[model samples]
Target: MKLKILLFAALCFLSATVIAQTKDSLKTELPQISLSPVPVEVFAGNNGVSFQLIVSKYFKPDSRLGFFNVTQFTGKYDTADQAKNELMSLALISFDIWKGFSLNTGAFIDNYGGFSPTAGIQYLFANKDFLIIALPRFDLARNYNFEAFGLAEYRPMFTKNWGFYIRGQAMYNRNIKQDFLERSYVNLRTGVTYQNFQFGLGYNYDVYGGTFNSNQHSFGVFLRAELF
Candidate 1:
């Protein structure tokens, strides 16, 4: 756990440099569609090491709404080698409810995680170089109830060809009748973005049932590309 914290700190250090750099006064637009691949390490839960591959897509129909899809495939080895997969999708609608603050809501569905209605808010600060997002949802499925997640990203462009970026995501889930944390997931990453290409190293963790219940941790490297 200590090592994982250190890795997260390293990513944040790169982001800290952005505070000293000049910020872009103009808002930069994103692509209409983007596809990226994320690979991570899987430790514990299973008896041996494993790898998880996720293919994700981001689509924006307009400035106010966006949609996303993620498919995951996992392979592992233990007493018996096995593989599993899941598909999750989301739709978000953005609103300018307050100054420097944005609100969005829609629905999220997953093959294994269950279907859930979700709402979120985002705050952009530090010359628009830093962003924070909070999202919460309730799964309609009988298996689970409430869940909340948040994401933070910091990107600072040093030049036309060089830039640094740090991103972190975490989620907490619980059952309807019970209080206290039930399930959790965390992802932390930091790397350099060169034009449309990105390379990074990070850690991934998932826990089910309780805080220290059945859980898995992984540290690995990932590469992403933006092809509009």
Candidate 2:
């Protein structure tokens, strides 16, 4: 009788341990989602409003192969009349093709525009707090234009909940008729963040609207929130 009781207890312990392990593994397989509001100068002058939503899932526990979808809107602030400049949605797959580098290939749709293929590369460092991405593509079928876009960002933490970040992006486009269109735009931003919220100020220069000698400056106030 004593031996039987000991065997029963041991079997129960093993079953419980296996169940816990399975639950943990399932949690790791789930995807992560984040949403934020990223206002821009193009919509409401200095008060333009934009939003972004991202959903990503890793193929394995090590975050090597990942799939993501990003959607964004930019234009004038919310209004009953026309208040939007552009709407963009992208579906991308990112893979750690080599050490310290990753490759991204995706399809993007612009403002009800047809789908356009995109391929880019990311250089990640400093535990992914610092990143540089470049995407240059030609939209020959729909827009008949060649475009190049680049973004650079750096975020360094001072403490657990405090940090600073600097980010910038540039875009250039050219069509058959013109060497470069008036669509060129550049923005530089720096700000302080607490926890998942960021507050900052930035400057935007619109090349299509003015020349460098008479460049137009758009001062912008920005805030971001991380909704998981």
Candidate 3:
């Protein structure tokens, strides 16, 4: 009930914002789209794949609207511990308010079948060789948790056809009402890039729960490609 109300309110707010902009804006440009088609990471006991899509268009020189989505699925290959298998997704609608800063509203669906409606602020920077994003949000459901996510990637060219790639990503979610950490993770990747593909080594450390927490460390290789 409350989640539905919050979702409705967010949709209304975004619609009003877009309608207001279109009233004064010249024209809407065609959206630019980017996709990562099932990037895979292979680990000793767990293997995972992730898919991402982003679409953005400018309504004015200083303002734009975008949609971002990410889906992750992991499987445990060595054990029957279904708890170690996970599926999660995040989807957001973002509206630029200032330079590299945006207001975002979205939903996060966790592996345990929990759905959280989230409202947040995000900062994004991207160029030919660098990309960075930082987001802090509040969960509108389930004790109103606070969540922060960050990602940074650098791909600098060593020659016309080769480049070095490194990326770091992190996420932390805390149940503020209960005064406990719900989930946290850090992921790192480094390797070389050729054309639109990247081959890399990856490491991830994940912790779940509050005082009696369970953690996991995974090291693996990964392959990623950009599909524009």
Which candidate number has the best TM-score?
Answer: 3
lDDT of 2 by residue, 104-132 (tens): 66776765445777554443333436656
User: Which residue pairs collide in model 2, if any?
Assistant: 43-75, 43-76, 44-48, 75-85
lDDT of each: 0.52, 0.55, 0.69
Q: Is candidate 1 or candidate 2 better by TM-score?
A: 2
Question: lDDT: which is higher, 1 or 2?
Answer: 2
TM-scores vs. true structure, each candidate? 0.59, 0.60, 0.76
Return the lDDT, model 2, position 52: 49
Off by over 4 Å in 1: 1-86, 100-103, 119-128, 140-144, 178-182, 210-213
> What is residue 61's positional error in candidate 3, in angstroms?
9.8
Model 1, range 132-204, lDDT digits (tens) per residue?
Answer: 5565545433443566767676878899888997888787777654555666678777889787666777777
Report clash pairs, candidate 3.
none
lDDT of 2: 0.55
Candidate 1 achieves a global lDDT of 0.52
Question: Best to worst by TM-score, what's the order?
Answer: 3, 2, 1
Clashes of 1: 0
> C-alpha displacement of 143 in model 2, angstroms?
4.3
